[model samples]
Target chain A: MTYGLFSKFPAQPGKGDDLADFLLEAAELLERDPACIQYVVSGSDEPDVVWVFEVWTDQAAHDASSEPEDIRTLIQRAMPLIAGTPEQTQLVIHGGKGLPS
Target chain B: MTYGLFSKFPAQPGKGDDLADFLLEAAELLERDPACIQYVVSGSDEPDVVWVFEVWTDQAAHDASSEPEDIRTLIQRAMPLIAGTPEQTQLVIHGGKGLPS
Candidate 1:
């Protein structure tokens, strides 16, 4: 089963770009991991908010993807730019384009 | 530039499956359209809410996709099962795996 996570980040005022850039870097880190299916970063009309949608081979793949030292460092750097706790929802992917059929 | 939409639909009690099925049907409508990049339907740990994350070649592509009669019918069918006004956020896709380089 494909596992996904949808997250909303409320960045500190004027820090949306900074936060999004950090996430793009994070996405790059996962680029080589075959178990990481999707890691999309998005910016919204709401200036202080950013969104990330990720799909993995399964829940375990997602859990292990964040264990790398570099990813941990990125998360540590990203925390200070966030205004509040990020919202996350775990997902079970039903089906879609860009996914294995 | 790629355009994206992230939506949250809260379904009436036990209507989650119905709403998700409708959205999956909706996804099928766009399968042949080259401009439709990704249309992922997801069920979450929150039993009553469904998440839809869509990416298009541009916002116009997404808008035009819903103009077809069948898609409109699906939307009409889906509306009643939803508990309230759905939340939609317009997105600017930054980049990621499974997206065009």
Candidate 2:
């Protein structure tokens, strides 16, 4: 089954662009992970918020990706710019256009 | 600029499959709209929750889509199956692989 993760990050005041840049760079790292199906980072209309939508081959793949040193470094880099704790939800994808069945 | 919408729907009790069916059908309808770039509906690990990730050509394109009779009908059909009010976030996409520049 496809594993999904949706997360919301509200940047600290005036840090939206910084947050977006961090995420876009993070996305590039994710792109090289064979298990990652889609990892889209988007800025919200609210200006201070960013959204992350991720799809992985399975829950294990997602869990394994997080253990990488590069990903951990990115997470640490983004921590200070975040306004508060992120809101995250885990999902089990039924079907989607981008996923390989 | 690309417009994005992320919504979460928690189904009432055993209505998950029913809700997923409704949204999957809705995806088919959305596919016919030229302005819709991506409309993916997926089930979650919680079983009762569903997530919708949408990307459009622009805000006006998204707004115009809501005015269509077919979309209105789909909304009406989906309203009851939803357990609570959906959490919706509007986004101004910075960049994503699937989006056309």
Candidate 3:
């Protein structure tokens, strides 16, 4: 089963760019992980919010990625720029155009 | 440039399955649209919520899709199952694994 994650990060005043940059850089790290199917980082219409949509092979794959040093480092860098708690939704992908069918 | 959309639908009590089914069926309709780069419909951890993540070639493609009769019909079918106002985020895809580079 594919594990999908949708998360919203509201950046602190004037810190939106910083958060976006951090996420873009983190995408590189995720790309190297075979378990990562898709990791899209986007800038929303709302100036202060950044959205992350991700797909992993499974729950374990996602958990393993979080334990990596690079991801931990990036999280630390991004944490201060976030204005408030992130809103997250975890889902199971039934079928999608991008995923392996 | 790609136009991305992340929308959440919170289904009315006992209408979760109906919402999921509607979205899954809608995915098939979207597949035939060339402008739709990717459209993934998912069922979330919250029983009553469904998440839709979409990528389009551009904003015009997205707009044109909304004007179609088929899509309009689906929207009508889905409206009754929804419990509250949908939360939507529109974004510009800077770079993503699933999108064409």
Candidate 4:
């Protein structure tokens, strides 16, 4: 089954752009990983919030994606910019446009 | 620039599956729309919540999507199954895999 996740990152005051930059960097990293189907980083109308919509080959692939040292280092760098605990909605993708049928 | 939206639909208790089905039907309807880039519907960990992640060629394309009679009628059918007002997060998509570069 295809795994999906919608996550919200609330940046520290005036740090929204910083957080988005970090995620865009992550998107670049994931681009090389075949297991990553989509890693779309977006900015919401809420200035302090950044959202990431991810579709992976499966749950295990998503779990292993964060284990790389580079990714871990990036996460560490991103932590200080976060204002609160991130929120995530785990999902089962039903498929649509842009997804592999 | 690409347009994106992440929306949450809270279904009445026991209507989760029904709402998901309706959204899947919408997905089918949208498959014929050239402006609809991605319209992914998902069932989340929250049993009563359905999430939709959409990407369009532009904001105007997205806004015009529901103007069609078929889509408007589908929305009306979906409303009764919903438990409360839906929530939407408007987005400006930067770029990612599976999206036009």
lDDT of all predictions: 0.90, 0.80, 0.84, 0.90
Instruction: List clashing residue pairs in candidate 3.
Output: none
Docking class of 4: medium
TM-score of 3: 0.86
Q: What are the per-residue Cα lDDT tens digits for candidate 3 across B1-101?
A: 78999888899998988898888888788878888888888887688888889988898998888677988999898999999998988888777565556
Interface RMSD, Å, model 2: 2.2
Give the number of colliding residue pairs in candidate 1.
Answer: 0
Weakest lDDT window of 10 consecutive positions for candidate 1 chain B: B92-101
Alpha carbon lDDT of residue B41, candidate 1? 95
- lDDT digits (tens) for residues B1-101 of candidate 1: 78999888999999998899888888888888899989999998888888999999999999889888888888888889999988998999998676867
* Pairs with steric clashes in candidate 4: none
lDDT of 4 by residue, B1-101 (tens): 78998889999999988998899899889999888889998997789888899999899999889898999999999999999988998899877676756
Specify the CAPRI tier of model 3.
Answer: medium
TM-scores for all candidates: the values are: 0.91, 0.84, 0.86, 0.91
Q: Please report how far candidate 4 places residue A81 from its true position, in Å.
A: 2.1
True contacts kept of each: 0.81, 0.43, 0.73, 0.75
Put down candidate 4 lDDT per residue, A1-101, tens digits, no spaces: 89999889999999999899999999999989999999998887788888999999999999999999999999999999999988998999977677867
- Local error of candidate 3 at A29, Å? 1.4
lDDT, model 3, position A12? 98
Candidate 1 regions off by >4 Å? Answer: none
